[model samples]
Target: MEALNEELERAGAWVFGAGLEPASSATVIRASGSVSMTDGPYAETKEQMGGFWIIDVPDLDTALDWAGKAGAACEQPVELRPMQRA
Candidate 1:
């Protein structure tokens, strides 16, 4: 993880990432004229999001390159998504 962050810094695209609480510790809230609270994961799945990183880069290609590096370093899948235009 440290190495991945370092690589992002070297590429001048580092942003920030926060570690998430365990899914069991998460709380879900819902509302539709009424409110409800669920004490657990938002849904059941074979996988769960552990954390995320946001990077600033010039374009999609650069972002994908960085994401590939991240995936290689962590031995886990990495997803890339472009932020909506302002």
Candidate 2:
């Protein structure tokens, strides 16, 4: 895990979040005519997502570089999302 963080740092990106939490503890929020909130995640099956990373980089290649390392650390899926431009 430390090595992954270092790699990202060296590449001028940074991990934003990470952790393990129960599926039941998760709540999904969506928007439409009115705000919508749902219980648990959309996927109720196992292989639940436990963590995430937000990295600032020029493009996908940089993001993938960090993702591969994180994936190995947890031996599970790691989701990546670009910081929204608002």
Candidate 3:
């Protein structure tokens, strides 16, 4: 993972990355007619996002390459999604 990060940094595509705490430690807040708070993930599912990386690559192909490396390093499936531009 460190090697991948280094490679990304070298390529100037590394924006930021981080690992999150367990889903059990999460707190969900909602605001509708009234504000409410709930414990745990917003939804229960077989898979959860353990961590993520934000990179600035030229295109989907480049991002996919990095995601593949990350998946191999972690021995887990990685999800890739483009960020919405402001």
Query: Considering every candidate listed, which one attains the maximal lDDT?
Result: 3
Per-residue lDDT of model 1, residues 1-86, tens digit only: 89889878887898887668778888888898999998888686667677789999998898888889888876779878888889
Give Cα distance to truth, residue 23, candidate 3, Å: 0.8
> Over 4 Å off in model 1, which ranges?
none
Q: Which candidate achieves the best TM-score against the true structure? A: 3
Q: Which ten residues in a row have the lowest lDDT in candidate 2?
A: 11-20
Per-residue accuracy of model 2 over 1-86 as CA lDDT, tens digit each: 77777777787777465666878888888898899998987774666877676778788887777777788987887776666799
Instruction: Return the TM-score for each candidate structure.
Output: 0.83, 0.62, 0.92
Candidate 3, position 79, lDDT: 90
lDDT: the better of candidates 1 and 2:
1
Candidate 1 clashes between residue pairs 3 or more apart in a chain or in different chains: none
- Clashing pairs for predicted structure model 2, backbone only: none
Superposed model 2: Cα runs more than 4 Å off: 27-46
Clash numbers, per candidate: 0, 0, 0
